[model samples]
Target: MDGKKQNKKGTGVKVALIAIFMIICLGVGFIGGSLYPLFQTSIFTKDSLITDQLLSKANVISQYIKSFYLEDIDQEEIESYTYRGMVAGLGDPYSAYYTKDEYEKMMESLEGSYCGIGVLCQKDEETGDVIVLNPFKKGSAYEAGIRAGDRITKIEGESVKDQDLNSIVAQIKGEEGTKVTLTVYQQSTEKEKEFIVERRETENETVTYELLSDKIGYIQVSEFDEVTANQFEEAVNELEEQGMEGLIIDLRNNGGGVVTTAQKMLDRLLPKCLLAYTEDKNGTREEYWAEDDEKFTKPLVLLVNGQSASASELFSGAVRDYEIGTIVGTTTFGKGIVQSIYPLKDGSALKLTVAKYYTPNGVCIHGKGIEPDVEVELPKAFRNSLDVPKEKDTQLQKGIEILKEKMQK
Candidate 1:
């Protein structure tokens, strides 16, 4: 009888606890329902000056312009200008606000293909000079002899001085087979040259592979994109089937595209270890690690240059820190910050820098680039000269020698 009483007491306690939990939940629900409308109004309150002063001012200005302007106003144009102006105020070269059309093109570019001459150009912030980063293989820009390190002087007879990269790109891109003449300062010849490149729908393939001497595989990664990691995997598999003894990854003039894509490629090549990490403004950190699994264990060499940035630095920096491969060529571009795309409802978007990346060893290459294990510089004479023989590329030769030595070891 005492045991039955104790069991009944325990059951009563559990029942009371459950009842209390249910009451608390109902109270929370009641409170939430009561405050829901207030919360909504607080966020969108027009009279809340402390919370929405800037937006209110903007609305006022827009209304005034619409009411008293001399001519009709395009609301879309005003909105675009406002968004662009706000992004420009950030003073960040990497951050940009894209209109719907521009955002579409940007998306296409990130997908490893676009309808253009297929040349990646970067503007020097200090010098205001536009330089070609890379000319896609078999694209019109490549066929027209445009190459990396070439300065774009004019597009369609208009001077490119003080023109931003987007404007220059817009002028160069058009319908397929439409010719766009460009004046460029050729880095190889140190002379001005003109080329009438026909604009076409070019697919910018990020990965290309070829066989090197002694069954060595040479893979060039032009940029990191959504499709790049898969392409790299296929290339590696094919090279392995071809009896490749070593591998050389050329990242010359490769301005980085996507961070996750680079991380995926690193996961394929690196051993089980910390590949990379990132830190936000709030001091929160996120790390990327690899498991001891199917990683490419062959002798490897990576080629980088001053143009290799962001994701390129992530790959090369981790490779050096982990001692996974021999990094050859000059220092990388040293862009450690990561950007995120926030797409607006109107098909527009904003690309903003949100966090900074670090290598596995906790080294940040923001302003200072990653130093290579073997430093090699390509001669300026062979920079933009597509016809230059492989023997003349000293950097490539150094990479090849390093890989061969590693293979022997």
Candidate 2:
């Protein structure tokens, strides 16, 4: 009987242990179910889940293309188009994705030095023809008898009508000592001409200065590049040496360039003041300032028009804010956003509109251009010409007039 009682006690102990195990497992299950939603809502997990979905979709599309595409695929071209599309989807005109070759060319352009038959050209708005603005004096194109106002119609016998400017430029640029054949329609001669020009490394001159009548200095800034700051300073110093009592800065048709170069140029002109500032998406602010070491104290006038944009607008806005100069001409192009180029490991780059820049007075001029103190319009007849004579340039004459008045004060 005692042995039977001990067996029942052992059975009871076994039953209690089994119950405890069941309860522990039930508690764990309840806790895990409760925390699952929290895990799904976590920042890290949320991003990962989205990324996984995107990858899955991309993989499916890629597999379909590989399986059923009719033509032989150029994988590299497809990859480049994919990246280009991704950036284009952002709907920002200033943002772009550059392939390896494109990125290299872009950097070369910003450096203001490149191996090419040096000629600056722009597509005529009304005629849709690429017109040569200026052929660098010592460059291959100039030596080959290319002149301003000539329309480029063919590159290497390929018709370039309606082609993109950058595409045409890329075709023109090549390895040093290479040759490029161009067919141009000369407007002055009213005849078509062809020439074969050799490419060479050329430095672009962005700043040009002259001492105008009445000791008024004239500086035309076409665009700001890496070499612009030093060139601008040299221009100013030379004009000052010539006893320049007043100045007129012509920024008409200037489409802008490197922002830091603009800031550097401003530093040479302004005394210890805030030049400009930018705020990124994260609300991070960066400020540019001009030190008090040097300042231009002469009577000043800045000329702008619809084409003066980006860094040019920044320079104009700062001068206006400081009351250092009188702005003459129509409103500016008003590109107040800033782009940051992020280089990838694969030699590609992404230029994104990362920030909105403001003037020293906290004015955001992105869509709304800066209005001039004295607005004057260029005559319709002189609009298309690359070199508008000072007498015919009503806007420039107004700037000169304003500077003279300021100097008389």
Candidate 3:
């Protein structure tokens, strides 16, 4: 009787919790319903400052523009003021609403096809330093002495150690043949040096592969572009045919591409179950999972660095959650926000941060990158050197060590 009573009490508690949840849900629904008509009917005037407080701001901005703006200030400048105010109002350092032109640049850069230095950037959580990892060979950064592990302390004298990754990249970017002065710090030293690197357009080579000693396959994913899945699939097929045992996916300096590419890669690794889902503000959720688990049963290692961001971080984080393989490198780039790229009627597009993403284990890497199994720092002495430093391959060495141990076992 006592046990039954206890069970009844627990059941009652659960029922009460469910009731509360449903009540809250209904309340939200009611409020949303109340607002829907207001939104649809254009109840609020468009030109009348969006918010009450903004009326004062709009007037002030109007006065300022009339006094200081060059020529007769057009709607474009006014709209820019509103956009700037929106970002400033959010009070979130990580979130920025990009304009059409800015969004186009972002999308182009994400796909690794951009008119700027071809490099990847991730941040140091402890120091808040933006790290440039593994600049593409013969690329501007590579030619300018930036390497796999170099911290960008400042851009044009503005310290980026406290700035967001996207902001730093924006400040550093420009047209081809133009120069951006970067104050870079090496991992081994406190002294920083200024490097004037010229900007250039990069035709992205999204994927590359190498056979390591006929038993290991080295696959490098520079970014997650539309073609990333095809390149990866082709790589796996080719490597498997050529006798491969271990695989290493180097995502160093890879500042994320497309989320869809990440899904495809996850499908290649995980079982045919739910891998991840994202929830939106309007209470919508979409699920994704692996298509099949019978693909590769071998050992895998994902190589990340300060610059491995977005979709790359998602892949590495998911694999880590599943315990499928080891992520060996420095910390990853913590850009977990999912941006929606919308094409306008014109040739332009808008990329806005709609929602953030999480790993299978529910880790949000928005500002904190994934920790590597083995933390590796490149040698400061050789970070700016032309050739790969002998002792600076801590991440790669750790990967090789772990792979060899797994092979031995």
**Residue pairs in clash, model 2:** none
Candidate 2 Cα errors over 4 Å, as ranges: 1-70, 104-114, 121-132, 145-172, 181-195
- Model-by-model lDDT, in order? 0.67, 0.69, 0.60
Query: What is residue 87's positional error in candidate 2, in angstroms?
Result: 1.2
Residues 1-409, candidate 1, lDDT per residue (tens digit)? Answer: 0000000111000110000000000101110001111122225455643446687998899889878999978878997888788888888765677788875643443221224677766565545556775677768888889786787788778887754454455566555656778899887799999998886765657798998879899999877755679999999999999999999998776666556677789889876788888777998887777766768889999987776776788889888998878988877766777655566666776766677778888898876778888877667766544334678888889988888788898
> What stretches of model 3 exceed 4 Å from their correct place?
1-42, 45-49, 64-75, 92-204, 341-351, 382-392
Which residue window of length 10 is worst by lDDT in model 1?
A: 16-25
Top of the candidates by lDDT: 2
Tell me each candidate's RMSD, in Å, in order.
17.9, 23.3, 13.8
Candidate 3 residue-wise lDDT, 231-344, digit = tens: 888898899888888888887656665566677877876777566555556656555567776556788888876556667777888888888789876776566655443444
By lDDT rank, best first, the candidates go 2, 1, 3
TM-score, prediction 1: 0.69
